[model samples]
Target: MTEQRSSPTTSGTTASTGDDGGARTGVAALVLLAACTALAQGLARYSFGPLLLPMREDVIRSYAIGGLLATVHMAGYLVGAVAGVRASARVAPLWLIRTGMAGSVAGLAVLSFSTGSAMVGAGLFLTGMGGALVWLAAPAVAVQVYPCDPGRAIAIIASSMGIGITLGSVVPALVPAVGGWRAVWGIEAVSVLVVLCVSLLLLGSRPQVSARAEESGGWRPDRRWIWTVVAFAAFSFGIGTGMTFFVAALRDGAGWTVRRAGATYSMIGVAMIAGGVIAERLSRSLGRMPVLVAQFVLAAASMFMVATGMGPVVSVAAVIIGTTMSGTAAVVSADLHDRYSPQQMAAAFGLMLIPLGIGQMLGPTAGGWAVDLAGDPFTAFMLCGAVMGAGLLPLVIHGCRRTRRAQTPLITGR
Candidate 1:
């Protein structure tokens, strides 16, 4: 019983009518969806990076507590992903995402009143939970809408996360000049309101599908997607470190202005949009694993370049990292979607993000602590790059396996 917002269809392809009425309606809906997801994720993802210094300075709390707030958020993200994996396929991705957007407002509101570490941790954890739900549903929804081009659609949604991260950081640099941290958060709440309205308009009372039942005949609903989870975690953590803390990293090391650093990062968002376009087109010809490996390698190199400190180098490098980072998630999702069809798309989605959460959690503290330990940020930056490089080993090995398999039939003349 799949009740979905759909066009009348034949077998594999959907039918198009005169004036393309269905196409117009679908485009409008997609635009609304992108706007809402970008707003929802941007609020949760970037708000913390901009607020990190202010929160620590204003509240007299530990940096550990501050960094851990992101971890807590990712922790909640983990929980939400797990839950979404279980429930999202059973329900509408729109419903879960909307609920997550609403939850973000509550988390932001709670942070406004906090005095210490507990507040930081609790606020981030709950906020992460909400963000996790929204993020989990987004890819699933994108897949539903563009079944044949899920990679491209997922890349777009993933790119939106990058947009949110950039907006989150940059908005503060300007707004705080006028209103302080509280002002930034007030704007966050309002932005979220806009998202809610758009979501209702685009996603309103829509029929939903169960991807789980369609993909899996009688496979267990709760099967653990271990490999998929690991891949996402690695990719997520590597990127998270950059988004959550690199602005501060630039400030601490080179005395770069927050605005300058934030603006530099915005390039990453632009690059992500570009990478997504490439990923979609290439997926048809390059196949899955090859494209993914290339993205990961590029992602690692981008981190290394940043840590090493190249003034002009960052501009081009940032574009490369930003663009490829989001694409990494799309690749992982494609891999999972091709191989498995468990009941819990959301949970599976979230579980895959665990490494991202963990990597994100480790990235900042390690970056900061290494600088603290080494007496220079260059050493610290190099170390973080190394950790990121190490994560790529799994992808490299996986790629090798795929290549060997592809060549096997040719070599044996099968």
Candidate 2:
């Protein structure tokens, strides 16, 4: 396949060069952006999961309140996702990236000093907004830096979130040594600040046009794109429920120790780091649509395994879910890039994420209710699998239509 080149007007001076130095700079910029993504998506957002119990002990006493705080964070993410669509139309992607990073830093700093549930909830809300903004805008910047290979660039950014989640999982272990949960937040704040500064230096204030704007011809959402967004929401719903209940299922249903369950859960994060790379390679070899379909099937199968409550099989299921969850999103984004103009990509992607945010907000609560009603976490797991299976219908239909359209010319020519 011929690599698509971004027009100079769209990509700015940095993307116009094919020299070795240009490539090095682009790589460096992408790495820095990936680091920002790690902090925003990984640490700032996920560190809450590990820190929640300790935070409850120190300030918030009720698990219900803690759960409510998480919901507030998701609400903020939904708001940010909506804002990102409008923000992309009025500002540069780099501006969105930097501003989002600043929000994460501020939220983390707030969490470090929070003494009450309200304060912690506020901090989480800020972090959620920041995370969503960064995620929505970073791909646009990635396309600018690596115009010829936006898929790879996006994969790097997506995979880096796994690194953050893995590191966040380790934060609880540091609570005693760090003096408290608050101190862990302090350290994370400093870490995010360091990355933010480096990103500012690496990506200067030069204005670049939207990625592929010249070739996009002002793209708008059609039936296919709308279907893609719905599929994305279903994907989010399935993964959110699965992740929310994964460790609980192992510990409560399979009679595993807390340590053992957490260790098994960490495997998901570790596998996620490799998910994007694996997906990109497979998409290159097998084609994006086929790879995407295979990922969903694997995810559904893995969820079924978890529902079985077989300890060994559940371990394998965790790994499979980790590998395919992020991988599916990467493939979906790359597929969307095939259709959207650079100028529209950020807004379009952000619009798609709104449903994902809603799904995330609803999935865990619904899963918890299902478990309560059925008196078994396994039932909820089965429901997650069913949701994913249902999600596959739209993608299959869209893919079949796409294939038929591609073949029509050959048939008519004959």
How do the residues 143-228 of candidate 2 rate in per-residue lDDT, one tens digit apiece? 77766678888888888888887788677678989899999999999999999898888788544654332433466788767776
Using alpha carbons, what is the TM-score of model 1?
Answer: 0.84
Model 2 regions more than 4 Å off? 1-16, 53-67, 205-207, 210-217, 372-379, 404-414
| Location of the lowest summed lDDT over 10 successive residues in candidate 2 | 208-217
Query: What is candidate 1's lDDT per residue for 320-398, written digit by digit as tens?
Result: 7777766766666655555544233334555565556666666656655656576665554566556666766765676
- What is candidate 1's local distance difference test score? 0.64
What is the lDDT of every predicted structure here?
0.64, 0.77
Q: Pick by TM-score: which candidate is best?
A: 2
TM-score of each: 0.84, 0.88
